[model samples]
Target: MRAVETGKKPVLSAEIFVIPIEADRFLVYAPLRRAAFVGNAGAVNFLADLREGRGDSGAGHDGEMIEFLRRLEIVDAGPETPPLAVFSDDPNPVSVTLFLTTACNLRCAYCYAAAGEGAARHMPPELARRGVDFVVGNALARGEDHFEINFHGGGEPTRNWPTLTKTLAHARRLADAHELRLTAYLATNAVLSAKRLDWVVANLHGASVSCDGPPEVHDANRVTPGGKGSSASVIRTLRRFDAEDFPYGIRMTVTADAIPRLADSVEYLCANFRPGQIQAEPAYPIGRGAGAASAETAAFVAAFREAQGRARRHGRELTFSGARVGTLTNHFCAATQDLFALTPDGSVSSCYEVFEESSPRAKIFLYGASAGAGGGWRFDREKLAFLRRQSVDRRAHCAGCFARWSCGGDCYHKALTVHDDGEFAGTDRCDIIRELTRDQILARIADSGGVFWHEPPERIAAEGCACVSCGDEGRIMTGRGVKKPDRGCV
Candidate 1:
């Protein structure tokens, strides 16, 4: 590392990023090392204390921070450390997602797939087998011990049970042939038959069910094509998972209307379903939700805190998007990970939201296709290059942001749709990203015995806070932020 010099002043490491959480309290994080520290008002006097060669306790918490800075090499560090390397262009991806079909039983108000009305599309058995061959070949070439075959779609994967079952079997055969371990994942709306649920529990490693929340909210949005509420069916699916103690989670979509009920939604899900985890995210204004209203920022944050509290009390975890403190990521999701999502017609899309080839976004994101040549699939290297360049380090607007690596310019599809320039800048959710990330940073600090000096033992009730919709139970902020499931959120 080369020292970042400035007129003889001791240089702070460029790798060390800071965010002020409250009066006299700050969170200092090192993305490259995935480490963090907390400091108070006196911490600001680091240079002065160091200049005087004093490590006196009279300097208080600032003096303690000074010691940590020296130990962590964040201060007294002459040179700026380089950021982590960019994602690989020639990737040997170990996971492949088969968009089983673009068909759904429910017509969610904000369905990005606009499911239930799309051209009925299903993945051919040939294409599904080819997708498995492609990913398994790459994993073997890379000498990876294991790989994953995931089911997802612009609509619902369970809708195409025959394709899903056949694909999983084919993938397992490929893994066995290649001497590799294999796992399966499903992203479903969970309104399928009881027999299907039995198959899912027996065959898949884990599943993520797309349910809004309590019946009232879930019924309001996740309805059948015939305009009937499908919440009861989804509830039954959740019950099946609970009965088996299966590893599964609920993915709750928070639309503008759902914002007020955010905490209530959490409580209801936790009380009724008791899922292992609850992954909540605000609705993006894309596809069907493009014409819908958005949740207010402050309200969303407050409700998230409340919901987070409720989730913890029930021994469950609640997650938000674009905010994971422990990860030092270069990309927010799998779009840039060389991962493949095979659409119905044998085309490969980088994002789940851009499955249809006719979509304008597909020009930039649809990176591969299988045309039945040699009875298999193939990737386009040229298109792959474009996806590789979508990392956070390559973005101009994300430059110098403290949460750059943690947030990693989340969701390229959303970025492209909002900015129309394929950059994750100026999005409506930026505030939520920062706030939720800061909460994690502070929590990590507190966990390490550093003070969250400004935080109340219990969350203060913000008058008129939408979190009140869940009840007046005070909350304490921390792990409510979004984290990628072990199987991923897709």
Candidate 2:
């Protein structure tokens, strides 16, 4: 027998062992750890067979051998190493958007807030302040120095100026007292005046305004509750702020009604308001407006690609938040985990849609914490775990997805609403991501003279999937599976 040194044994034992019949070496199995390997050459093959229940137990019996090997620890020789930190250890806390009020003056039909006369209740100033304090204090306790506090609304955020001002002031004070950094942002319709703009500039780091495309598309989608077009007013307000050098981004929600003029809408935005960034979201099926059809989504994506080209032609930089890269990548839905939404009442959600009481995933909320006095602020880890589990478990299809790491699987609410599961299922959303990423890669490859490496495989797959039905088998195969694309291949 080969003299084998023994070390600390594993806590778990194996149920099966394999030994070579011709050689003196044997093999030990540790099914519990999903591992098995060769042992010392001194061990008899017949002894190994007997231990494995394949031979007469008394023939090659070595009771001490079984015990000695059992006491030995197996060393891993695999190349991959475990990560130093797990996903949960990431320092950035999920963002939480707080909508102070649902009472918007403009009546965008697709408004998720359901603002206006019959929407949810508006959060009062005190309640809004409490929510801010709760978030700040909670973050401080977690040793997180910075926190993102976004103010969203059902109607116009400025309409609730009183609450907004107080909340900002309160958040700032709490940030200072707790030695934390706080960033404020707002998503509005851009219908406020100079005074309101000044207040926003002083309090908020940035703002996002809603505009469909040009005046025509904007006017068609955004109207007051009274049915009056809001394009003229919105454009006027946006220009006023733009002239003042207010930092803002243009947000457009593409709908079935807006898809026909997608290219024009993109052109309209580029021409009228040269924004810092352009963000587009397909209309979700909830509240007044339901989900846009697959055809409409495809059309919007095509138009959006054209828009991207137009932006480049004019030397404007356009970025997509959760868009796929090439044929290998998937849509990046940062909001699912990277960003969070906090309601006016201090209830935390993954996003705005999750704030709706009717949403199955909405139950995950940060009410209040025990470390802070006067207010209770807490992040529900259990709920987050549940959500994370659901994301990984239900979306097994996404596990092998090339865009799995980057995309984080589109909107959870969209998955739940459209597919009846909070997990992403195959849909046109994947197509949209693939097309956008393919365009991006093609442009990059052309610019680099077609000699580029380190290009993401997911991006390539996304590009490949865009042209034809790539199917969801996770691997692209050619002719009897004799040749297969990379894991990220289309």
Candidate 3:
């Protein structure tokens, strides 16, 4: 904002967007201020005139429109954009994700890594020990009490049973030796044998299972080596998990063929199994699913919304990765957050999608490898810096997007594939993000008495949002008054 005098025409403070809904009605939104309202053409014109510095635009209705805009902090809001999260250059991480192997029992139609197609690469237990040692050393050096080890990779982690258990035992020994806590998580297909399932239930702190709904729906894609649907085994795993009361989340991948059954799938899962959270995503057109029909379409969005409704009735939540509306962020996932993921080859990968050397974007995401000796790792600082620079605020394509902050520029890997390493012009996922985000905004309004939706600046700041003005850390300048978040607010 330019310097304002005692009596000057006010300019638009926040980044405001006017989305046309129908013939005359418009959705006036200020993403930075977290304010949204439905308005007519007259209201839109009033805002335009104010932004263009016209004279006496808010003169009608006793200047009530001006007062209303001011209350919403869209007219004179100052510096309410959430702070862009920063990453460290030193890259000392306290968590490590081990991609156990490039082997799987199932040949999912959309297997990103094309697992089991090529010669399988199993992670040697010694490599796992080295990775764990590095993170545990970092945790101890940083005075952190706990370190995390996540089981994730291009293939089924349980396929490498020996290394998987050995890695956990090694991490436990280190945790005991250093008197630190060990947190472990697994992301698996859940097509496990009874012995392995029992071991997982007794061992891991939490797990994320991949199950795409009922038998027919799941069978369409997630099939075994013998071309049989793996849903029975998956359901058995879920039943075991429920019986043991294990902490877990269900991740469902919806292909184009399965989009119509999305709602039914969610209903089945909710009715039968108990998962702490249910995350749904359209199958990416990569690996074996490449050149296939695109699933990131309007129909998918409708199906997701319907599925969400079904889950809500069952007291469950269905989520899309890029459509988060309430959270404010600049990076979508740990891909941009320097995730310490060790591949089967002991090479470092920041993205779960780029776990294999054969990946098209492997050169871009695989940033480092082991230092060859004891416990140290090597990284390319230039690559790390490039990855760290990928924030939503830095993207030109996402500048005008209302969901930029919430979606955090969407998935970086997906962006690369969509644009072919060129400028991020956006992909079909952008529409899905916008539509879902708009729905979330409307839901917030209806939930909060159904007229307009506005979040207090201090409340946002209280949640560690560095959106203050006047260069003061203790005070947040808003249209209301100088407000401060209460101490120790979560």
Task: Point to the candidate with the largest lDDT.
Answer: 3
Residue 397 miss distance in model 3 (angstroms): 1.6
**What's model 3's TM-score?**
0.90
Candidate with top TM-score is: 3
lDDT against the true structure, each candidate: 0.68, 0.52, 0.79
| lDDT (10s digit) by residue, model 2, range 398-425 | 6544343334455555566667654356
lDDT of 3 by residue, 1-490 (tens): 2223335455568778888879998888877788888899998987887777673433333256666787889876666656587766656777787889999999998887789887999999999999889888888888888787778758999899999999999999999999988878888898998999889999998788888999999998999988999999999999999999998888888888999999999999999999888878888898889988989999999999999999999999887877666666686666666777888998897777888777788888888899997569999888888987888899998988988877778788888988889999999989998999888888877786887898876766654322211100011111111222211000
| Total backbone clashes of candidate 2, pairs 3 or more residues apart or in separate chains | 35
Residue-level lDDT tens digits of model 1 in 1-490: 2232232333355365567777887676665544566766566466444445453333243344544565665656566433343444454456677788888888888887787784788887878888778767777777777777778867788888888998888887887888888878777888989888899899888787888888889999888888899988898999989898877777888888888898889989988886766778887666677788876377888889888988888888788767665555566666665556778888887777777787668887888777576854567888888876777778888877777776767777778777776435557677787888888877766776764322221221121111101100001000111213442332
Q: What TM-scores do the predictions have?
A: 0.84, 0.68, 0.90
TM-score result, candidate 1? 0.84
Whichever of 2 and 3 has more TM-score, that candidate is 3
Error of 2 at 414 (Å): 0.6
Least well predicted 10-residue stretch by lDDT in candidate 1: 468-477
Is candidate 1 or 3 superior in lDDT? 3
